[model samples]
Target: MHTVVCIKQVPDSAQIRVHPVTNTIMRQGVPAIVNPYDLYALEEALRLKDRYGGRITVLCMGPPQAEAALRKALSFGADDAILLTDRAFAGADTLATSYALAAAIARIREDMPVDLVFAGKQTIDGDTAQVGPGIATRLGLQLLTYVSAVGEVDPENRRIIVQRRAEGGVQVLETALPCLITVLEGLNEMRFATMADMFRAARHPLTVWDREAAGIEDITKIGLKGSPTVVSKVFAPRPRTTRAELIEAQSGQPNDLADTLLAKLFTKHPQLGRQIVRRSS
Candidate 1:
């Protein structure tokens, strides 16, 4: 019943700004916080830990500054926290990120066998939503995405059931153990950390691992060299120049107002009016 939750430190979206000249995200001086979506996964893992009485480990791969994100997870009663950081891991795309994460998890498995791994559906910064699935593919773990609820965990039978979100309805899926779940937002609300837990988090010794420590053997499979996707251009949306025109009805009646609006619309765009009539006919 050991669970590993993957979290990421992201720039607060509310404070994020685009550079005017460079047309890129202005991360400088932006406050960093744990990806909000990941909190749902963490809270869900905590709930499972409370019920099953098992240890939970919070893992993250980022720069040294990401240690704060791991410490925050510690305050939420995670049994352990691991930060995987290295220069080789920088500028990694989803593929490289998943590769590094999968390697670290394998390293962690040597000490304590991990039964389940939880992660957010996607990161705020990188909304590609590919990393979790990539990790599952690389690790050969059962992949379950957009899980709204975890139904049952039968460790003795080595099976688990979950409610996943689909297009029209929810799907109840029964999967085997050692599965990777990408939790959707609004699954559970995060709990407040107790004063004791806060103190413990402050004093807790974090396990920091570099590339070699995390057992990443393939040098060519990490960092910028491993990233295949490239951002060619980023720019702010152009401001709209068109202004709304007001249509007035003297009588203020619904039919009159509609007629006035339609008249104005037809006068403004005769082709649109003809298209509407053709569609109706």
Candidate 2:
């Protein structure tokens, strides 16, 4: 029951800024943290490890500084950490990222057969929600997205049941082993890292792999070259200038309050009152 969890190091959205001239994100002086959504996926994997007593591997693809993200995962009790970093992987979009990750996971499978893979529903920075599905398709694994709960796992029979959140209602899904799941938020709470685990995480030697080590055969299928998406512009939304209006009821009763509110609303916008009268008629 070996599990692999994918995480990303992203700039804190609250501190993010856009370059006015370049129309790109200004990462300078911004702090980096693990993607919040990925934490849910990691927690789910940790719970599975606790139940099945299997090894858990944390994987990340980013710059060398992204090692901090992997170490954070280690502190949370992951058994192993792997960082995929290379100059050739620069400027990768979701497509290229999934391709590289899929290739690296294949390399990992060579060493130890992976029973399941887990990832977040989406990244805060990109918010595209495409990479997980892309990885699943590349690896020919069962794709499970928006998973709210993992119900049962029969490792002996390679069968697993999960509760998926859909637009209409929750769907109970049963799939075989070697599946990839993109977990939604609030799936489970992350546990606090113990002092011993923190010490171990600081001293653990991470396994870093370049493109060649990650078993990437085609150079044209990774990095910016493989990415077809283009960003035309990046900017902040305009702030609203309108202010809220307060309505006071003299009687301080529920009916009086409602009447006052409706009177004020209709007075401010007569068209609304006309529309209501027409509808009633």
* Highest-scoring model, lDDT: 2
Candidate 2 per-residue C-alpha lDDT over 1-281 given as tens digits, one digit per residue, 9 for 90 to 100 = 99999999999999987887776788889999999999999999999989988999999999999999999999999999999999999988989999999999999999999999999999998999999999999999999999999989999999999999999999999999999999999999999999998999999989999999999989888999988887666567765878767666888899998999998878988999999999999
Local distance difference test, each candidate: 0.93, 0.94
RMSD over all Cα atoms, model 2: 3.9
> What is the Cα-based TM-score of model 1?
0.89
Write one digit per residue (lDDT tens) for candidate 1, span 70-138.
999999999899999999998999998999999999999999999999999999988878999999999
Error of 1 at 215 (Å): 0.5
Candidate 2's C-alpha lDDT?
0.94
Q: Which 10-residue window of candidate 2 scores lowest in summed lDDT? A: 230-239
